[model samples]
Target: MKISNRSTSTGRRRTSAAVALGAVLALTATACGDDGSGGGEGAEGSGKGKIVFWDNNGGVRTDIWKEIIADFEKANPDIDVQYVGIASTEYQSKVDTAIQGGGLPDVGGVGAAMLAGFAAQNALEPLDGRLAKSSLNGKLNKDMIESLKAAGGGDDKLYSIPTSANNGVLYYRTDLFKKAGLAEPTTWENFYKAAEKLTDKSKNAFGYTIRGGAGSIAQALDAMYGQSGITSFWDSSGEKTTVNDPKNVAALEKYAGLYKKVTPAADLNNDFTKMVAQWDSGTIGMLNHNLGSYQDHVKALGVDKFRGVPQPTGPGGRRVQVSNPVDGLGLFKSSKNKEAAWKFIEFALSHEVNSRFNESAGQVPANLEAAKDPWIEKAEPTKLAARALSDGSTSIVQLPYYLPDWNTISKADNEPNFQKVLLGKLSAKDFLDKMAEQLNEAQKEWKQQNG
Candidate 1:
């Protein structure tokens, strides 16, 4: 759901505005009637009507959809899909309002983290039977499907299928590395040394850039926790809060260390755009990020500016990758075009469409068949990402939605403590203890709300 690598020059507020303008334009141009579904509650004059699909896959991936639309229309002359692209930031709140106001889309986008929240509210229709009957049953990446099922709950009833699979990795300026005689950092200790050596104080250069904006510092924290094998709150079962675990404390220590040596003084307010800009300008030597914005970098600085490496291993001997599966579609329970929506979903997941999307968008496809495509092997970032996904040792953090109290636990309680800890304003022990206490409170409240 999160697009990585935004340009540093475009401020967040401006970037958000631009995306919103695009969304408004797309919505106005595409869906202009009494809803795309063509009727009320249970009206049944269907087969050749329209289905609204709200998503943010508007860049290169949108073009792929245009091509797919041609093919799908040719195959099923009856169904017309009105595609509306919404910016990712506005997606959750906007969709929630629409759903509650009784104006939901027939089929809507669901990112890995958003799926479980929506499903928990019964906003999504189960697709277990539909997937089995369609040609797409065997075409998707098994791991991605399993992840979706996990996000949707253990019932094996899927609400979304990832359009792509992604894992965060280390991207560094190869030229900078060579100048400093530094190879990729295999361990946390080595990474620190490299950061110290590469930082040129005279040129205002730092070892690595980071995202420290309000809404994004947690992401940087996620990368640190991931690289250090720290659990945010609950353990793997999603049962109990444990953000204060000793391992988590260790992760915070590592983060504080990173802030001390590698990061720039201005990094406390930096975002992805700023970090990538610093990197491109040769001011920073390294960064930890997702590949979503790789294309933008290629456009701004050219293809030769960067290369990918695995995330550095922590003290625990684990190299975890902070990841979120690609956004995909899910049917709404109140759809008049349920069958037609399923048909389109089936079409979208087919090998032909999957290949087209991956090829054009530069995204690693979620289809098992598409992963074997020659293009994937040829792309450096894609190749490294694919290798990590297929690596059996890799572990996934639960999507934000899977943890019901994620909002309160992450934003309200832990985030402030995390900031204070990182700034050395709060001792790591105090921060962790407070985080644990807050998470336990949230878990108790959530149980009461949902039980």
Candidate 2:
């Protein structure tokens, strides 16, 4: 399934080099149909009355999706849903190729990170009109709907519907905190002090774990906002980059300084899996991850050992966290069976089906009613996150999700520079400056192209 708040992987090592190569392939590869024509088999209006649906995380969530598809098909005897599962890492490349080469699926999983890119290519069908007439109109979360619209170039048109959300959390060892006489880390100042006090270098114990590989940018961004007090990723009109703001630079510097003091040197190359494994197996005081890793943490260190809290706050006393990356489903523009596909989408999003899916996936369902499911109510992380979101104590820093080059800049380019910062080879100012420059250029180009 699409893991929230972090990149989905099979606990494999995802180095910067590997990710760069994948980004290169995704960008450089070309296919026919630049004019948005379906030139080959399974092209628009070409499928033989069968609904071909693709699962973004093929092997990871194939069985679960297959079960859902089976239920859909069984309920509608006349329609046959063809299932195809694609790995998360390769899904974007495959979809990009399909958009240009033909043979797009009727409906498929689309990540928040990739939504703008795909929508910009004119590959997705707008679903705002269809959603208004369906049962999902009042059921889906309103904030999430706004998020989808902002991601879709802020045109007030939704190209995809949110399926679930993963919120940022700080998981800490309760026993260790009690032993150290430290209060729960509720603020950045307290968290830093606790990290310092918890570190026992001779015992190989650390205060926190850092993610320097693959998905480092998001974690760093969260830390930056928590310390900086900046609330948005761009200016009012979305024409500037805020990465290099003085406040943000100070935040990044402070965050990077935690390395070699409260964190292990080995953390410089750790991905989420390796970092989570380290925290799970060792005497770590706190770990930064999302709700997606909740199950893994619970499986490793039972419920009594640790507790998950929302990300810490800054001096302003507000918990400033970035919006959790969303997982969504989009309708392809080329699909001829739009009506039947909408039926399937509506069915999957029904209260009961939505509850079942999120319960199995261990994420907060996008359906507002599904959030009240007993399974979610019993889960500590979900409950705490819901409180944080609704209590008005947490401020979500909405990034410019409409930026099509976000994946390339954030993942492929920003990761290696972050690694350099951790290694002391690059200064935080330099890193943010370079990142801001690249993003500014991208923002200008996007305006020129779209306007």
Candidate 3:
């Protein structure tokens, strides 16, 4: 929670990866078959009963989840489904509170970013055995399956079922670009120049908007690495991060400096929604989001006005960006009805249901059959992205999704410091240094515990 343009491209895998996501879809939804208050004794509970399914991205993805719940309940009248929607920004904290105090959902979205953290706490049920017994055994994407395993600490044990790969997309105003005499924003140099030239503060027009508040770290890191062309998350020795390298700091400084200079002052507190709203309501030159926001933009500004493209290439004319996070469904260890929970997951992953969900979100589908839907070909951004990545001219920088602390460090610990850098209260170097320190320590601790 994530595009609408119409075009065709043959490489949907690259496009799916490219046009897939904006926010990492690590939703902490729950689907319990018994009374949620029943608590911790559900390790071997039955599978059919009352289910409380919670969604972290309430306003953004509420409709699709609700539709899915309705379909699931309709198909299995014996199972009762409860729906709860929470804001995306507050989801992580809510999950943390639940993890510590009590109450956890039985089944829901357990994506790559949160897999490590949740698995380390023993909150998720191992799904390898369940998959082996289900009709979905050979119908899933192997790469997505591997990504989940990598996030769960490079093990053979599977904790979550693969959903879809979520990637960052660059949405721009085609009309504005034509008027400004600017080229399509496919390269970093073009991005900077267009940001400067298209901006006219007197008219309240801007080149771009920034996600400075909640969920800011991922976007910033993508920008830093995408521009600096630093492809490794860690150094050559694997003991430290290359996040604080001179090239990266320079990249971040330039990207963040657009906060008020070319972007709006409201950006200081703007999340994805607000930033997208600004882009839609006003004359925005470009916006960095995913397929999740595509429908909104289309309704607000019309499909002809804007175009969704893959993230811009670095200075060296090579496409470089952070890899997309894969999202999925997981069964919680606290569920009283494991069998019932697995049923719901299987129902949702059925070809039609999964395809509808991704089509609505403007993302790539994880189900092999769903991915083959005709809707994917008509998706402009997804197709364009496929062409960008599948053409052998791209280099994706893989973020450390395997680390248990990856989500916490990227969101809670570093988001505030990242904002400080935008406000001129901290240097880009200091922010990166702090993030590097956290990542290095997390890797070290993981090695000590795992080894």
Task: Give the winner by TM-score.
Answer: 3
| Model 2 bad stretches (over 4 Å) | 1-50, 57-63, 77-89, 235-238, 336-340, 448-451
Candidates 1 and 3, the one with greater lDDT: 3
lDDT per residue (tens digit) for residues 321-341 in model 3:
887778888887767787778
| Clashes (candidate 3) | 10
Ranking by TM-score: 3, 2, 1
- lDDT score for residue 344 of model 2: 76
Model 2 vs. true fold: TM: 0.84
Who is ahead in TM-score, 1 or 2? 2
lDDT of 1 by residue, 117-188 (tens): 566545677888877877777878777777788667334588986787656767777777787888776667
Model 2: per-residue lDDT, tens digit, 21-136?
A: 44333333321212223432213343225677888768656766888889988888777888889876568777866765566777889877788767766677789888998878
Which of candidates 1 and 3 reaches a greater TM-score?
A: 3
Instruction: Single out the weakest 10-residue window by summed lDDT for candidate 2.
Output: 1-10
Q: Per-candidate TM vs. native? A: 0.78, 0.84, 0.91
With a 3 Å backbone cut-off (N, CA, C), the pairs that clash in candidate 3 are 2-291, 2-292, 2-293, 3-291, 3-294, 15-386, 21-167, 31-107, 46-337, 47-340
Whole-model lDDT per candidate: 0.63, 0.78, 0.78
